[model samples]
Every structure is written in C-alpha cells, then in structure tokens.
Target: MKARVHVMLKDGVLDPQGQAVAHALGTLGFQGVGEVRQGKVIDLDLAATDRATAEAQVREMCEKLLANTVIERYDIEIG
Candidate 1:
C-alpha cells in the first residue's frame, strides 16, 4: 500500500516564507496574486494490506511526527 500526506498551515496561520515568495514574485512583475501558502507532501510505501489500515497508519504518522497539529493541518490519502 501507499500513503500520501499533505501538511499545510492552518487557514489563519501566517506563512512568512510564502509571503516572501509572493512579494518577490510581485517584484518580478507578477500581478493579481492575492495570497500564497506553502505546504509539504510526503509519500510513504507501507506493507499494510488494506486502505483502511494504511490510512490509519498514515494518520498516526502525521499526528506523531510528520506535522505539528497546533499550527498545521494534514490530510492523508491511501492507495
């Protein structure tokens, strides 16, 4: 089984890196950009036999170590 995890800032969290990138892009002549958010994607290959088990493990991984739940949100997809 395979699991994909996406970790991103919460809706109201301020992302300094994303802001910097957006600012730089604006300086480079990019226009009409409202906002920018940055996130991370992690791919994992697991030995679990079913999607349910894989999903559970992925969630555990995210909660335990992959993401900081205080300021970030994570979603897991299994295949």
Candidate 2:
C-alpha cells in the first residue's frame, strides 16, 4: 500500500516562511499574489495489506511525530 500524508498549518496560524516566499515572488514580478502557506507531503510504501490500516497508521504518525497538532492539521490518503 501507498500512503500520502499532507501536513499544513491550521487557519489563523502565522506562517512567516510562507510570507517570505510570497514577498520573493512579488519581487520577481508575480502579481496578484495574496498569501502563501507552506505544507509538507510524505509519501510512503507500507507493508500493510489494506487502505484502512495504512490510513490509521499515517494519521497516528502525523499526530505523534510528523506535525505539531497544536497548530497544524493533517490528512492522509491511502492507495
């Protein structure tokens, strides 16, 4: 099974790194750049036989180590 995990900051959280990227884009002549938020995607090949089990494990990984649950949100897709 393959699992793709996406981790991102929750709404209302300040994203300074994203803001820096936005500013750089604007300086490079990109217009209408409103806001930017950075996130991470983790792709893994698992030995689990089913999507349900992989999904649960990925969710647990995010909650325990991949992300800071206090200010971030994560979603998992299994295939």
Backbone atom clashes (below 3 Å) for every candidate: 0, 0
Tens digit per residue, CA lDDT, model 1, 11-32: 9999998899899999999999
Q: Candidate 2 residues 1-79, lDDT tens each?
A: 9998898999899999899999999999999999899999999999999878888888888889999999999888899
Q: TM-scores for all candidates?
A: 0.94, 0.95
- CA-only RMSD, every prediction: 0.8, 0.7
Clashing pairs in 2: none
- In model 1, the worst 10-residue window by lDDT is 51-60
lDDT of model 2, residue 38:
92
Highest-lDDT candidate = 1
Error of 2 at 72 (Å): 0.6
Regions more than 4 Å wrong, model 2: none
